[model samples]
Every structure is written in C-alpha cells, then in structure tokens.
Target: MYQKNPNLYLKNQVMSASPNKLIEMLLEGGIKNIRLGILALEKEQLVKASEYLLKAQDIVSELRYSINTEIDSEIPQQLIQLYDFMYSQLVIGNIDQDIKVLQEVQKLLTELLETWKEISVAG
Candidate 1:
C-alpha cells in the first residue's frame, strides 16, 4: 500500500491549477488570514493579530504581482490599486489592533472572491 504525502499532493494541486483557480485559492487564503487576524484582535492577542494580518498582506501582494498588466492593462491596474489599498489597511489594522479595518478588508476580499468564482465558472 502506498500513502500519498499531503504536502506533495498540495504542491501538485497548486502546480496544476489554472490561472483562475490559482487566483481563487489566493483570495480564499487572504480571506482566511483576515478572519484569523480579526479573531486574534478580538482576543487582544496583538502578536498573533500582527502575524495573521501580515500573512494576509503578503497574499495580497502575491496576487498583485501575479497580475499581468500586459494582457489586460485596465483591469490588472485596477486590481493592483485595490490590492495596495487592502495591504495598507491590513498594516494599519495590525498596528492599531482595529477589528473594524479587518472587517472592511474581509468584506472586500469576500466580494472579490465571489466575483472570481463567477468568472472562473463562466470561463
């Protein structure tokens, strides 16, 4: 009997994912991190909150970097701006321990994730 390694399986899944799928995964990850950050904030766990928020910021940065400005200039540019705004808000939220800011970011991420899901289904 052969057992599959979870790490290897996940790597393969990511390697084989379509562009839209990858974006969806990133959005889901960002949303998860934001939710965790909000939870930490509510618990007054400043260090954990900062770590989670920073992780979410990093995910948004990855999303921004993955965008192809050459392919679709306007949309990618808009996404870049939106990601930048989210990153800034995450930074401020972490620094100030603001759950409200995290909530706003979470809402944006949820909407974007839903939109990406729709686009992926259509295309």
Candidate 2:
C-alpha cells in the first residue's frame, strides 16, 4: 500500500496558495471541524467533540489573527469580533457539549465559505 503524507501535501498546497486560497482553506477547515464536532456532540462523545471543536478554535483563531489591519476600514475590527465570537462559542459548546452552538458556528463558517467562493468567481 502506497500512502501519501497528508501533512506534506497540505504544506505544499499552502506554500503555493494565494491569499484568497489560504483564507478559503482555513474557512473550509473550520467548517469541517465544526461539523464533526456537532456530530460528536450529538452522539454524546464529549472527548471527540472537544478535540474537533478545539481544532476549529485554532483555525478560527488563526483566521482572526491573520486579518490585514493595514487595510483602512472598520471591516477588520468587525471580522475580529465575529471570529472572537466564533472562537468563544467553540469553547462554550465544547464545555457544555452543545450541538446547537456548534451548528451556529458551522452556519457562520459556511456563509464565510460562500462569500469566498463568490469572491473567487468575481475576481
């Protein structure tokens, strides 16, 4: 069996990706993890849910911190706050094992992904 290293593949993709692509990747990752976390919470798998949610928190935190504040506008601050809320929700939902909280995060991430898709198409 020939197995490819997913980490190496992902690293190459990231190294070659444009800024927009990177953001899309992060959003997609966050959404995927949130979806997994939701399923884990629904099944009462607190440990697995916590693990997935923590990964989501990390991705969201990265997205939040990676925002370009140099672009003069209120958008950066707004995005920071949104990401902050999502990050906190991940924590709260993990501790409480709340499926709804995870679902909310999933919805937000999906919306972000949709916007990025549109941007990519228009750009």
Best by lDDT: 2
TM-score of each: 0.89, 0.92
lDDT for each of the candidates?
0.89, 0.91
Shift of residue 122 alpha carbon in model 1, Å: 0.8
Per-residue lDDT tens digits for candidate 2, residues 35-110, read 8888887788888888999999999999999999999999899999999999999898888888888899899999
Worst 10 residues of 2 by lDDT: 1-10
- C-alpha lDDT (0 to 100) for residue 119 of candidate 1: 83
Per-residue error (Å), model 2, residue 66: 0.5
Per residue, candidate 1 scores C-alpha lDDT tens digits across 11-105 of 88799998888899899999999999998888988888888889999999999899888974589889989999999998888888888988999
lDDT of 2 at 76: 92
Those runs of model 2 whose alpha carbons end farther than 4 Å from true positions after fitting are none
